[model samples]
Target: MFKKIKYGKIEVRSQTLVLFSAIYFAFILNLAFWRYILGHVQINNFANFFFIISTAISVVSAFYIFFNLIIVPFAAKPLLSLLLLFSSIVNYMMFSLNVFVDKDMMRNVFETTTAEAWDLVTIPGVIWVLVLGILPAVFLIRIKIKYLSFKKELFSRIKLIAIAIILLLIQVPFFYKSYASFVRNHSEIGHLLNTSNYIDGTIKEIKTRLNSNHKFIRLDENPSLVLNDDGAKTVFILMIGETARDANFSLGGYKRNTNPFLRKEDVIYFKDVKSCGTSTAYSVPCMFSNLTRSGFSQSKARYMENVLDLIKRAGYDVIWQENDEGCKHVCDRVTIENMLERKNSPYCRTGYCLDEVFLEGLDKKLMNIKKDTVIIMHTMGSHGPAYYKRYPDRFKIFKPTCDTSDIQNCSRESVINTYDNTIVYTDYIISSVINTLKKFPNLESGLLYVSDHGESLGEKNLYLHGMPYAIAPEEQKTVPMILWMSDNMKALDYINYSCLKSKAKDNDYSHDVIFHSLLSILEVKTISYNPDLDIFRSCRTRRFPY
Candidate 1:
């Protein structure tokens, strides 16, 4: 049978090999193509390139193994295409499951699957989950399995299809999330290498450069500008917000009265603050890095050092508190990120908990601190899917909660209202923190709040965060930036406040300034600090040393 399947001069197996090779070759080309999409040189590390190559090899090898072990014996069967299509479905299923399971990865923080997932009581999501898992697997099986029959019957296939439907009923979520992440990460290349995750490896290289650039000021390296009346106490708090939109902020001058509290306060608010990107996956890492959003995504991670790491080294008492599942590895090196976060701990919440949960332990943590403090509170404000999850029950300021993840079921107004309510809660939390600073007698206290990234509440076809940078909406790119400093808290001889205010108020600054701004405020010396990178440092004389 294999002998008759020759085309011109080539045998069937040779033909399959050639075709498979071509697909994988295209995968390699896609790696280069990804760089073009970003319009930058992809200076990926050795591991990144290795990842691409390995992924392509793994997929091809899997196909080969399946074909040789199972499909070759069933060559008489004509169910190959159906099998391939089925596998695509399963891929989607696994992808969904993975995303939902890895709380740190996606919307993994839910205590329970949202009510929207249920279709009538039958659970339409079960059907979806199965389809996501079963289809691709069926295709893969069909491709490699050897089907033999003296005479094949067309009508008999009906039973097979039914069987497939039944199988899909059992395994959707697992299949969906796995495939989705694979594609989302590498689909830009449209190649088989996605199975290997080379794209992420490349992304990591650039992250190093970004982390290296994350600091502009270190507190211990320089004395606090704002001194208490007694002149013996010191205090500093860095409030890292999560997914708060600039357009929704009242202080940032969003037409909506989103941030009424900040607007009223005498805070140094940046009217034109721009996040490096639209998604937390990209933005959080970028915000803590030296590079701008564009620059960080392409640079090498090995070359950078995060601001937090430096603060700890500078002998300041570093603390990391969180009300969110938050970013992975980003906070790994911080002295305090572990003590405060509930990620892997027995914290009742998953990806998101209440803002009050964060506010609950706020006072005891900060009062009576010894050395200068670099406290970073990673909030769970405004994460999507269940937009209402981030705020407390009382702070459900937005009416008609669009608690369902399915946006089509909810009106745009309902979703925004719920999200804004969360933002309002975030503002209240910030206010409480600021108020705490005012009362604390020890140190000059300051609050710098920047959201990890903005989100999409169903604008155009964009559902949530993580839209590719190329097509991200303005809503996703713009973010709220507020610096609340007490009257006495000013860099004594460092730089001009008016200049910093003017620069920050404009939307030109990206995550690049975060490092320098922190360094300037903390007085930590770092070689990576660039006045040009700092929105406030261009006028400042002394530069920070990393």
Candidate 2:
């Protein structure tokens, strides 16, 4: 039996019922945080349980006090219930995926293609939402909460607020070291807190996108390139790869021959190359901009006219062919084509296309090319969690591969086999592009393949990518970079093929090199070019040699 309290104009509900209800909701909702803290922190004795319990109580009491203010005045019980349900759903998905709800994840939600989004839907995810979110929400809406008068409600809120403050204070001494360490080492833990996570992500995304959308200052003026007197036409192809890790490629000394085709194509593979960021959204724009990893920011990258623009300004014809998402505004000022939109292409499947699809009209596209030209191809190489869908069935050489979108549900070996098959397919695509380049014998040509970023494949219990760059694992930062030049292009004394080959195996490179390397190779002269960041700078022993 619950005791009812008297109030000014309204009948007071059972005080015991209200108190227990708040406690129950708080305890259940904060379960994930408690588990995370318990697993991470060492337990010396029963005092550890006290700290953990106090932490959960503090969170719950805080929520209770805040909800009391709104629920009494605005009849916001349904609103609070809805918020809890929404947060529960978000938390459930994150728990199932072993992911944190952060700004980058929010960006992915916003920018993902239809096919990619469909890949995220699974029976397990649905069950998680139903068990954690919908079930609780249904019970919450069904609960009967009696209203007290304004005066009595206000008094009750004050009492609860006092209790919450006291409970929070109790945590100070017991959890000081743990709290400080967690805040220092795992600062992003704040982004995992329910409701706050999505709120923070939304705010940051809005502010960052607004800043990026503003007009940017131009980097170069009157940029130009003077060709050698030999009058050889230059054709530079930049292959922008996606979600490709160096560790998985045979060319990078991996045990598997994932890059069998590229390995035999006489390509110069650059080992130890790191990315500017850990996501395509960050890395694509950063790699094209005249900014080093230290100087990079999404806002700045969005505003600046990148290496391609400067190359175009220097009188070289530039075009971008994309099978992946749009170029992150990198090709805004250049000629650009998307393969997915092209009709009658057998390579297009379920609203997405493979990397090779972009090469269909290549010969016709290059028939009237300029003396100096640069073609950039952006690939959808090995994008997950549907790695099996990235390539054709014929390329599924690795048997027992994970064919489902739920990569985590599959065995580790199957997931890896699926991923490796995608790599092998990518190798084939790159080799095909090389063979296409060989068709035009009259022009001096070169191809440089650089991934936007690397991927995580069940390493440290992490899968996929979009991790923060500073704390990202080596798999997410180290990417494959391969280069190839036609015999005619390699013959130039100043081009220095030997020098490039000599350092290709040992030199350390990053996305920072991309901007300047393109400029240097294209013979573009500009004030913004930094020779130090150019990978070819050491190789160019005779810049003036004709």
Candidate 3:
């Protein structure tokens, strides 16, 4: 069979292949890990240098032992090749994009759409994978492994494992204190461990999904609307933003005029608001749940009733207009208008539609509003590495933008320019929604615009979001939240706009306030409503008209 093949093959012992693969992963495939280690660990003397060398040896030995145990004669080549390919891609993302592949990021990967996934596929990334991942994997597939007798192979594996363990253990005793201190301070180091990081993350995500019971747990049983004395219908729009950080908003003191349109509106901009999670997979569902950021669980929230459910139960016409990805399953029970599926809309292209697509039939929808309603417009705001694609060319107010998805290749100024342009576009969308709402004076109208999470635009070498919340920089957590209420809505709800504006400026807020705030805004009286978390509680002069 080997002689018949036209392509040449390299014959090697199973043990030899495992050792080489382990060394390759530990050294060549772990550039980000080694870079992080070197940058964080200071070498003051010969002893420190020796400790670094010992750490490398220990990592290499550990990989060798793991590979030796897992790689059988029949499965060695395929398994190792797959690992090499995946590790190379992971390494490129970590080293170039500065993204950490933890459980939440893995969840993002699984939940990401094909179009969103393609946005990440850049020329540089393809080249990196071809050179480092594909070439090695192909070479590995062509290699034939020679196995010894069963008893001999078993003894050989045991001997190698013992030697690797000894090498790893010897360093621990000499540098135990150094290791402890390094781990204690830099807990994020584990997220850089090339293959293990993503693999462990994937496993943990899978386990969480499997363990979830998927039962719908209703929160409020007899929730009812606190009807106002005035017979006017209320229309509230909750605009959920994507990848929009407060740092770029002019309303939030950003140098650029990203919120050019929003600044002109009567919107109250909350500058110091944080998100429940750093990624959409976690934050979107979390913000609507009664659970606060610290107490949120994705599995539990998935099956439980959220704010939308409660509001719908309270007799409001709830509709979710999705322009981004599928609402992270939060709109599963609600009436969803998937704007991306709309036929031949001018704002839509092949893969995705711009935020303006939400305005297409919105006027007609607003005109037909008869009852109190809550509409969620989930906008594709500043979602990148294709920030340039999020907005139209006319909205490209910031010039010399980073046009390509390979954002790392662009200058930092170009990246920010491109990102700010998206914010500018978002400002247009939000203002358009508010303007549309303003036209309908008969209906008590208002809008709440809050980002699901923020983005990292080359801050601290971090290109995008999804860093663990514990160590995530403010760039990924701090988001802009804008609230707009028409005069009629304010009068009907007895909400003091001045008081709310004061609260927006002085108080610290997070995604935790969203559920209660929505309940308070709509006057949905239920046992699940917590007055303490409501930002509008103090501002509302009158009590609920139950």
Which number leads on TM-score?
3
lDDT of each: 0.55, 0.78, 0.90
Q: Which lDDT tens digits does candidate 3 get at residues 1-546? A: 123224566667778777888899998999999999999878988877887998899889989998988789767767888888899999999999988889998999999999899999998899999999999888777777777899999999999999999988877789988888888998999999999999999999999999998888999888988865578888999999999999999999998788889888999998689999999999999999998988899988988899999999899889999888778878988899989898699999988999999898888988888888899999999999999999999988888899999999999999999999999999999999999988888889999999988999987788899998999999899999999999998998889999989989999999999999999999999899888898888888886533
Name the runs in model 1 displaced over 4 angstroms.
1-124, 131-233, 297-299, 337-351, 491-499, 538-546
Off by over 4 Å in 2: 1-35, 69-78, 81-86, 138-145, 211-215, 228-230, 544-546
Structural similarity to truth (TM-score) of each candidate: 0.63, 0.90, 0.97
Q: Report the C-alpha lDDT of model 2 over 1-546, residue by residue, as the tens digit.
A: 333345423232534445654665565554555556767766777767666666677667776665655565335556766766777667765565556667877776777778777777777777776776777667645555565676886787788778877878877667888667767987766755666677688788888887676777799987888564557778889998889999999988999889878877888999989999888888999999887889988778778889998999998888898788778889999998878887679898777887779678878765666668899999999998889889998999988999887888999999999999999998998888888888887777889999989888999878888877767899999999999888887765366777788798868889999998888878788889887888877787666211
Candidate 3, pairs of clashing residues: none
Task: Go through the candidates in order and give the clash count of each.
Answer: 88, 0, 0
The TM-score, computed over Cα atoms with residue i paired to residue i, of candidate 2 is 0.90
